[model samples]
Target chain A: MAGGFAESGADLELVGISKRFPGFTAIEELDLTIPAGSFFALLGPSGCGKTTTLRLIAGLEEPTTGRIYLGGKDVTDTKTYRRPVNTVFQSYALFPHMSVIDNVAFGLRRRGIREARALAHEALKLVELDHVAARRPAQLSGGQQQRVALARAVVNRPALLLLDEPLGALDLKLRRQMQIELKVIQGDVGLTFLHVTHDQEEAMTMADTVAVMNKGRIEQMGAPEELYELPKTVFVANFLGQSNLFTGPVVSSGKDSIVVDIGGRKLEVPRERAQRHAGEVTIGVRPEKLQLHGAEPKAAAGTNVLGPGRVTDVSFSGVSTQYQIAIPGLGTVSLFAQNRDVGAVLREGAEVWVSWDVAHGFGVADDPADGPRFDPDDDTRSIAVQRREKLEAELEGA
Target chain B: MAFGAFGGSPATTPASDAAPRRGGLIALFLLLPGAAYLSLFFLVPLVSLILTSFQAVDPNAFEIGKFVYAFQWQNYVDVVTTYWPHILRSFGYAALATVLALLFSYPLAYVIGVKLRRFPLLQALALTLVIAPFFISFLLRTLAWKQIFSDEGVVVTALQALSLLGPADHLTGTPFSVIFGLTYNFIPFMTLPIYTSLERLDLRYVEAGGDLYASPASTFLRVTLPLSLPGVVSGTLLTFIPASGDYINASRDFLGSTDTAMIGNVIEANFLQLQNYPAAAALSIVLMAVILVLVGAYVRRSGTEDLL
Candidate 1:
């Protein structure tokens, strides 16, 4: 059964693609390429054009401009049916009237393949849903229906399988289970799978390559770990995970590292990790990378330390405890400590020092007008103030 | 009494016992008006009609309404033999009209429901146009069609000029006019239900068909048609049941004459002009039984029993 769908996948290339609807553009002059047999994820929030890109690749929507190539052949003008692509839609969209076996066999029968039912049964077995072969889609649970949807698409053995948030509707546990199952399925079939989702963790966990999309363009794209560790843009840092950012000017540019001055405190970022060398830069450190100490600890030679801040809030989750420390000059910075510490849990109003290795810090070009600035003397301005201001602005505009 | 019988069950759980007994009484009370209305208006008339169908006509009386209560099943036999042609014509015309109406309305419903969905205003306007005919009286609408297809009307004259009709041919008081009237009148019935189903249709299913390597036409046949089968079944039933028993379109004063008379027209003549109540009642019962059987078989074969 696995051998029947073991054909190698085709590489997909989109050149200068732009999709413009009335009054607004869905995607702007985008170029993307997915090497065959790789699981690539397009990760973004809703309305960020990730789904549109998937649709464009699937040939469900024509690009307003630019060409598409599949396996070195231009298929820009090909109809959706003519393209060797299939989609596991966001809603699954199984034919409610069709039995599970028939739903899986639909594509095979359409291509006039002989013995379609036997192949469909094999596909169902691949998804571990063969027991529900004779049941209608409405009769199955949501997770079962989702598996049926996956089986239906994979059975076609299309060159590229487009998954449009295929697990969005499932419960968290089922979604995680399906994510692993999907990766295994992709490996078995050796097909190019383009999974589109808003979930950053899902993308990070399952994709070989993760592309962070914003507005209508790709913010950054690389291997999941590479993109997470070395995000080149502020949006990527903020969207992919929690980041504690500080905007400052580059005071010293050394051959090995760039030192940035933030409200009288100095921090060093590795020269290669710094996107900008001399101009104003926004440096960011992940919360988990930051270590919290009750007292001023001895800092290593290359370690960056910011300190003497009062802990404003402490939340002890089962596996980790998160602390929001408010520095006098800076607004607030969040740090996460794993539950490995056997000492007393840090309480609110406790004085703490935050430190991380200089190598863990990354810097992107600063935009002064984009977000809130931390007032040096006033410690009252926080995320709430920023959010209230944003809401007020939106209300006034509306 | 029904409430007492239900409450007397010994297997009731203590927590649910009182609540269920009260609920049953309330349900019975709520059912009073509709049950009484159906029994008084529908059941009483149905029973009287069946009884009259088996009554013996008075051979000695001069009055027309005089008949003796007896099991004269021959009344059913006489009516069936004398009006079998009319009965067959009624069903045949109804079937053709239903088919024509479906073909005409399916596209209309698709456009209103799916194609124009982005423009809600246009969809609403198109739906209003479909239902606008109901604003006029059914008789008035049939009469309007009769005038449009009359001997001197524009349609007949144009057909004559186009050599589509014989020189001496007339349009009104013909089978074509009657069937045409039936199709036109019940088009809204067919279009509305199909539109409802199509409106609720998730477009992703159609797109999924295309994504699975099915062509545009094939997608429509396999996905769109089967998903909307319930609507089609109901629409056909709505059109056929009434169109088969319609008297206005096939009346002599409307679009039909003696040659195009249906069972409805035959029953009307016996009941009103001829004052042959027993024959009319027997014919009415036959029409009811035949329609019941056909609709039952149709619903069963269509596999939409859940819809009914």
Candidate 2:
């Protein structure tokens, strides 16, 4: 794997890197190797070390331990200006006084590039911003200024391009547009792109390889689809997409699957998924994989396992209908059903059977290292959404 | 009609009726004292000066004029030409003194304003030193300089010991000594304003320039110097205008008849010794006009009238 990645000539290797600021650890034992010409994303919640890892790779901060390698050379102690890397800050950080063309030419000018005016004109044309070449940053819209910053960094053709939440400040529509634009630019330049973001949808769409980080450590790293489908850790499962997790114990083990007795219901899930100590386990299933049927299946069809549940809530999305079902012994489980037409409507408080293919259900091994069991009633809502509400209420109070 | 279309009207309207009542009171409070003071001290003295300039001095040395109708216009012409060299000498000394003061003060001001911005104690020390020259009386300082430059003075004696001085009356009473005195006296005026302007200058521009790959020297020349022009021009004007009218340095350092005799000495001589009030007034008027014209052209050339 390392050899295949290295021959591409722009591999970025971060080894045993740890950064600490006084009492806070920003990055700990971070080891990641990104292939050349790949769009890689460091996806995490806020303050989970995604931005810190980007800064470390850019040589803006020194790691407490280990080394960073760019193009197969150790560049752990290199100065930001001397390194073959550039960052597009979230604020755009365009020089306010200079024309857009000059802003693009700033790094080149520092390197004593002759004919800067002509070269800057070319870079602007690359970003499709040549029309605003003579305008200052303040005169342009937010999107135009962002394009200028992008052009400014790529004009150097550095080995690695670091983007620190570069699209966090833009509106959703603009962000989606810029995402396609960034991918195209990275493909054209053939430089290693390391993007940091807290938006899971953004990471899924833009990144070829998405690394999910939590509390300064990567929980999983793989192709976007691979990570989303077979997320080994509960953190990765909930972070990448919506998951309805059920905790219980393993009633029996099979050749290729395990039957988990969740509350009182038995679930036969993929045995290859995660380790099961033969007692306690949690089963995770994607909401889209779950299905609801009005009639119970025949008990003789042993391969197709089923359980009865009542529809507690029904939410209408534009193209789909989402149902929250409460099992007799199990907690609420969410399922998304395709909305074929207006006639295909499901009412709340209606009895239904919930079932899924064994392949779709993954058995997460119980953590033996855990000190104690978590209360089922513990709040499992996303901390990010809760934080936003808390901040809004505090602002209103103030 | 355009004003009416905009809903504008005068005292017949309620808003207009109340505005003047308050404005009239404010006008009386703000302008009354200043106007009365200018009428008494400024205009009355200026009118009297004009009256005296036209008067003739009798044999008994008392000036007399009947409506100043018997104007001696020749006195004006005589003063202009007779003391022309002395007037030029005063201006030359002043210009040289201002230049020298700028040279001595600019670096000090730049250091205080730009480098020591966080240290208020350093500024306090500089302020104390700036006003230290004023602590000594002007006459006493000039006299002290005279003694120091005398043949038996410490400086000349040291120079003689070093075999750098010629026979007698070589160094003292020269134009150089007069300029030195003036620069020493007016150094503070040149420094404080330049320091103020430089202190208020935002340093972000310099960093921005540097990030654009311009060297530090280029940054200073292109960004720092152009932005600090107002300070330099003001400091130069402050030093130049006052120093030009100052002949005290020249009169005291040069004694009776030296190359350093300036316009102030000429004016003083005409007033006391020759008892020629008209000539003295004509000379004074000419000096004021010259200073005014120079300052006006400078302000125009600098394009900093509003800044002043």
Stretches of candidate 2 off by over 4 Å are: A1-9, A275-279, A294-313, A326-329, A363-398, B1-308
- Each model's iRMS: 3.3, 7.1
lDDT tens digits, residue span B204-249, model 2: 5554444333457766765577667789898999899888877677
Off by over 4 Å in 1: A1-6, A342-344, A366-398, B1-18, B306-308
Count of residue pairs whose backbone atoms collide, per candidate: 0, 0
Residue B80 alpha-carbon offset, candidate 2, angstroms: 12
Model 1: residue A78 alpha-carbon error in angstroms: 0.7
Tens digit of per-residue lDDT, candidate 1, span A1-398 = 11143367889999999999999999999999999999999988788899999998888888999999988889999899878888999999999888899999998888888889999999999999999999989899999999999999999898889999999899879999999999999999999999999888899999999999878999899999898898887778877777788888899999999999998999999999988998788888989999888899896889999999999987665577778999989889988889987644788999999999999999876553463332321112233456567989999989
> What are the per-residue Cα lDDT tens digits for candidate 2 across A193-298?
9999988888989999999998899988999998888877777777777776777777888787778777766777777875563777777888888777887865
Evaluate model 1 with DockQ and give the value.
0.50
